[model samples]
Target: MSKSAVSPMMQQYLGIKAQHTDKLVFYRMGDFYELFLDDAVEAAKLLDITLTTRGQMDGVPIKMAGVPFHAAEQYLARLVKLGKSVAICEQVGEVGAGKGPVERKVVRIVTPGTLTDSALLEDKETNRIVAVSPDKNTSVWRGHRCKAANSKPS
Candidate 1:
């Protein structure tokens, strides 16, 4: 679908999603953070949250799912534990503060390999982040890296 065909809010979401295609976008909408389209579908399944349609794009309904902002930490912990990364898109401006849609941005990106939240970690054990990458020289070669990150309250 053309850019002009989508709502301004969706346009903003698309712009951010484009930058992090590999991660789910948690778009802030009022008291909740919403996931749309494919993100909604996947999150609904993984998080066992309600999945519904909001609007239409092109010729299809826009799938959507959301978690209350106040309880987002639990949902986020679940996703991170399930090996999913999330781009937390937050509303950075007041409603109706601008001529267009409320301004939003990816305030933080939480990945399994970059977890630093105290609530998501075990109380007594040291938490760690692990990463693996394919080697450049040979097809079968790969490298792994690990780092310990002490979780702290945010």
Candidate 2:
């Protein structure tokens, strides 16, 4: 049986996924990252992979796809680089929490510039990210700094 089979936290995560049925959420489950239902369908389409389904929850079939935990940063980088916004759901308690279920919530949402893990970023090139406000009058830019000493003669 999978960890999710006996864990209420996993069930709650699934609930959260159901709420955001439109976006592809990287639901972090234990040492692997997973996608459920429509998110899985969309990710498989976008990533060019097979679409598969998992167990039923609340009488509805759950679609899923996953990658190892260690590889998640890299995978997330690729998705973000491809202009996909991702919400990261993280488990909040230690392994043996006995309080009905462990606590879990979205630790952060990964966007282009907010990425801090060096393993998921390029060292030589700048990772540029832009945010445009809904009003169309405001904009924000975030990225690494440019070195004045490294400037080339024009």
Candidate 3:
């Protein structure tokens, strides 16, 4: 399949996924958050959800998996607990707003290190954010050189 063969919606998804290759993309589609390709494969295994092939992209089958929009919180919490980052892509435009696919954007990126949502955090545990910076100055140590003394053979 060629680039032209790919659907507009998929093209939009690809564009977002390209920017967030390190995170699983929860792409909003209708009433479900869909994951595609490698995201689909990894998320399906991690979330214990069904993995199915939707269509094709560039001659390869496009793997897909999804969770219902209404019950996404539990799934998201689990993913975060297991040290996975997710990019939440939501439909920003109305259904009848335009002629082509409705405009969508990544509204939020949730990661294990950046957990702030009450739903994703534990009630009793304390949360901390740590920032590590490299030292800009390099230090040089000075040492005294010693001359070797000649010894007589015994």
Task: Highest lDDT: give the candidate number.
Answer: 1
Off by over 4 Å in 1: 129-154
Better of 2 and 3 by lDDT: 3
Clashing pairs counted in every model: 0, 0, 0
lDDT tens digits by residue: candidate 1, 25-48: 999999999999999999999999
**lDDT of model number 2:** 0.66
Ranking according to lDDT, highest score first: 1, 3, 2
lDDT of 2 by residue, 17-130 (tens): 666554567777678778866778777777765667776655566677876778877777778778777887877777576766566677767766466555556556445444
lDDT of 3 by residue, 27-128 (tens): 999999999999999999999999999878987889999999999999999999999999999999999887878999999999988787877776665566
> Each model's TM-score, in the order given?
0.82, 0.64, 0.81
Indicate the worst ten consecutive residues by lDDT in candidate 3: 145-154
RMSD of 2: 7.2
Which segments of model 2 are wrong by more than 4 Å?
1-11, 18-23, 48-50, 113-117, 128-154
TM-score of model 2 relative to the true fold?
0.64
